[model samples]
Target chain A: SQQGEEDPQALSIQEGENATMNCSYKTSINNLQWYRQNSGRGLVHLILIRSNEREKHSGRLRVTLDTSKKSSSLLITASRAADTASYFCATGAQGSGNTPLVFGKGTRLSVIA
Target chain B: DAGVTQSPTHLIKTRGQQVTLRCSPKSGHDTVSWYQQALGQGPQFIFQYYEEEERQRGNFPDRFSGHQFPNYSSELNVNALLLGDSALYLCASSIRGIAKNIQYFGAGTRLSVL
Candidate 1:
């Protein structure tokens, strides 16, 4: 079963515009990580935000986690056509002894050139 | 350094047949995990292996099992498969003991159970 729910199941935006996706989970997480997957391919790790950390950034991606609200948002600044792909949020449980991460259904982003 | 690798990019099997899928973890990675993704759905965790041992398992039944070798390579086996079992089987590798270790995935094996 998936632990998280990603909002805006699908989004389409023009190039250079920002894209924002949100995720909400029900459990107390040790960390939350985002991943990207091109069609017919495996996932790629994007960024991870620890429970104690509220926000993190890498390249044009900015992720903000609000543990109090049990939600997180991923923002892609100046999105490009290459940014088109599915984004997923996975939650790692706290002290679960190497338990596997639970992922959300994912949000599909389409960037128009 | 080579990333995680999986064999048999695609497979076709009939119901009740058994199949084995293999995976080799990325260099220096010691943990291997398996996931099943049905079409139009998120991947679901199957199990995780560390130190060549099955450390944790997800909601899957006994039909799904796996083995981790000393080299941190892994294989996922399914017996008496059902048509519903058809999906993308992914292998992910990560170093153990790192807090929230980032997992690297191999292009998954697409299994089609008829």
Candidate 2:
């Protein structure tokens, strides 16, 4: 079973616009990471932010985690057609190993170019 | 230079039959895990294997069994398949056990049960 849920199940935006997706989990975590999936194929690792950290940035991606709220958000700056894909947030629970990341339902982003 | 790879990108099987899905871990990886994702749903954990043993499993029944070979390649077998079993079978590999590990995934095998 999946331990997290993502909102805006689906989103559509135009090129050059920014996109934001939110994910909420049910348990404590050691680290929260984001992934991207093209179609129903394999998933691509994005960024991982540990629980002790509140925010992280890499290139055009920004991820924020609020442990008090048990949630996290991923922001994509300057969306492009290549950014269209399903984004998922996964967490390695506090006591759980990072091996199998508990994933969320995912948010589908469609960037219109 | 090869990433994780799964054989038979697509498969079709009938209900009540059995099927096998294979996976080859990325070079230098020693752990393999399996997941099942139904249409429009998140992937569900199946099991994890390391050093030719079943290390951990999720809620799946005994009908779902797996094996990790000495070579670090793996195979997932399911018996008495149901339509609900038709899903994307994903295989992920890691350098060590699942705990505190980052798993790399394969393209997955799309199984369709008729």
Fnat, 2 decimals, each candidate: 0.56, 0.54
What is candidate 1's lDDT per residue for A1-39, written digit by digit as tens?
A: 889799989999999999999999999989999999999
Ten contiguous residues minimizing lDDT sum, candidate 1 chain B: B94-103
Candidate 2 on A63-110: residue-level lDDT in tens?
A: 999999999999999999999999999887676563467889999999
lDDT of each: 0.93, 0.91
Off by over 4 Å in 2: A96-99, B97-100
Local accuracy of candidate 1 as per-residue lDDT tens digits, B1-114 = 999899899999999999999999999999999999998778899999998888899999999999999888999999999999999999999988888768899989999999
Residue-by-residue lDDT tens digits, candidate 2, B15-91? 99999999999999998999998878777789999889998898999999999999999999999999989999999
Model 2 chain A: worst 10 consecutive residues (lDDT sum): A92-101
Q: For model 1, give the interface RMSD.
A: 1.6
Supply candidate 2's per-residue lDDT for A94. 73
Query: Model 2 residue B15 lDDT?
Result: 99
Docking class of 1: medium
